[model samples]
Target: MFIELDFQDNGKQSNYQAISTLAQLGYDGVVFSRTINDVITKNDICTFKELDLKELDQNENSSFKNLSSLTLMKNEKKQFRQYSRLNIIISSKKNIFLLKKMENILKTYDIVAVFPQSTEIFEKCIDLPTIDIISFDLSLKYLIKIKYKQVNKAIINGLFFEIRYSSMFKTKQSQARKNTFSNAINVVKYTKGKNLLIASGANDPINLRGPYDVMNMATFFNIPFNQAKNILTANSESVISHGVMRKTYFGVIKVEDKKKIPKELEESTDEDEDEDKNKEEIEIEKEEMMIEKN
Candidate 1:
């Protein structure tokens, strides 16, 4: 499923009206991004559940069920596959190590993202394993310089770099647009379009576009054609998986009695082994194909 990871909030609640529009534009899900301060005064977790929304189920267990009271349309609520994301603001150098202290707090949200305002903050945030995504204020006229070494290190550690196309296309500032293009080009240069997530960070419905349209526009940032599709598909899915795994426990817990195996253990299957093997082969094949094509 194609997921839009960034949508600015209206007041304290998510704008479901705008999110419903995304469903018509070919988006399977939309992530509501909330901004939090440096200090953790409140450990509020995301109310929306993190169930896989590939097949639409509008029941109580539905991922978007939490938004029922926010909007009156019963049919529109299930049309959205929603997840709550927390964007931690890192302004000063001292805030770099804040993740270490907020490990428990971080577990509450479905996804945790950090936006570094300065080079020092960016350098530190890239190495943080607790966070799923690393992004910058690309819409700014003066953007942060992206280094290959840092970008490579982040990718190696299984973190995604976000590209918000919604803001870039809607902004009237020429310098902001130029900076977005230049910064994105430098990012695609280092990572070569791998481990990058393309999202529509739109505040309004007017800023949203179809998934393929966003993928097609990504080439303007110098992303390879094949990899651009993965940015919206595989790469975005990786971020979602990393986010859900942040606080979830998939392993079995040992008990005193050997005969009494927990239901979790009994239900476990090795079906994922072949799937993992296939994924590795597919990824390597894509890399080889892109290398040969280039």
Candidate 2:
């Protein structure tokens, strides 16, 4: 299923409206995230178990109740999956050390993302085990530089780099749009298109696009066709799975083995036994007839 890691209800629409729209647009799952400033403290990790969105309690405002009350949201129509994510914005070097301090709290969520304000802050947190996704404010006047060495290290360590396409759509000014494109190129160039995630970061549901449309936009980064497909499908799954792993007990997760077994090696049932006996008797009769003829 294709997953979008960034989504928030920005007053233009309720949480359910945005998610329902995403489901209609062919997104199989989404990450509803809450952003935190500075070091996360006092067990502020806001994540929950997966549940059906249709089963939730409704408020007078005609929206799903407080987001903190739920962790997972599913829609039966598309079997759409919803999970919570936590984003931490790191603006200073000192905040990097605080990650280790709140390591336990960070693991409680299904997804954990970090936005580095500067290149220096990014380097310090590149190897952090608590982080699952790394995002940059590419629309800013002063963009964070993406270096191959650092991005390679992040990829090697199972970290996903995010590209928010909705940012470009949000900005009207030519300079901001130019910054978004320039920074996106830097990110795609250094990462070489591996472990890259494409998200809308969209508050307005209109900013969201279909999976194929998003994949097509990736061609602007010069990514190959087949590899570009992974930006949304395979890579997104890996990021979500890794995020779920963070919430696991010591990094272990249970998975089913669906490999097909050969029919020749399977045991026969009662009907097969009857057929086999008839075939054996026929073979014995044939052998006796041959002897008589001889």
| CA-only RMSD, every prediction | 15.9, 22.4
The best candidate by lDDT is 2
User: How displaced is residue 3 in candidate 2, in Å?
Assistant: 1.3
lDDT of 2 by residue, 90-195 (tens): 8866666567657778877788899988887887677677889999887877767766667766776678998888887776788887777778877888887888
Best by TM-score: 2
Writing each residue's lDDT as its tens digit, candidate 1 over 114-161 gives 888888678768656678988777777676876766676677666888
Extract clashing residue pairs from model 2: 48-71
Q: Where is model 1 more than 4 Å wrong at Cα?
A: 11-14, 47-79, 249-294
Query: What is candidate 2's local distance difference test score?
Result: 0.72
How many pairs collide in each candidate, listed in order? 0, 1
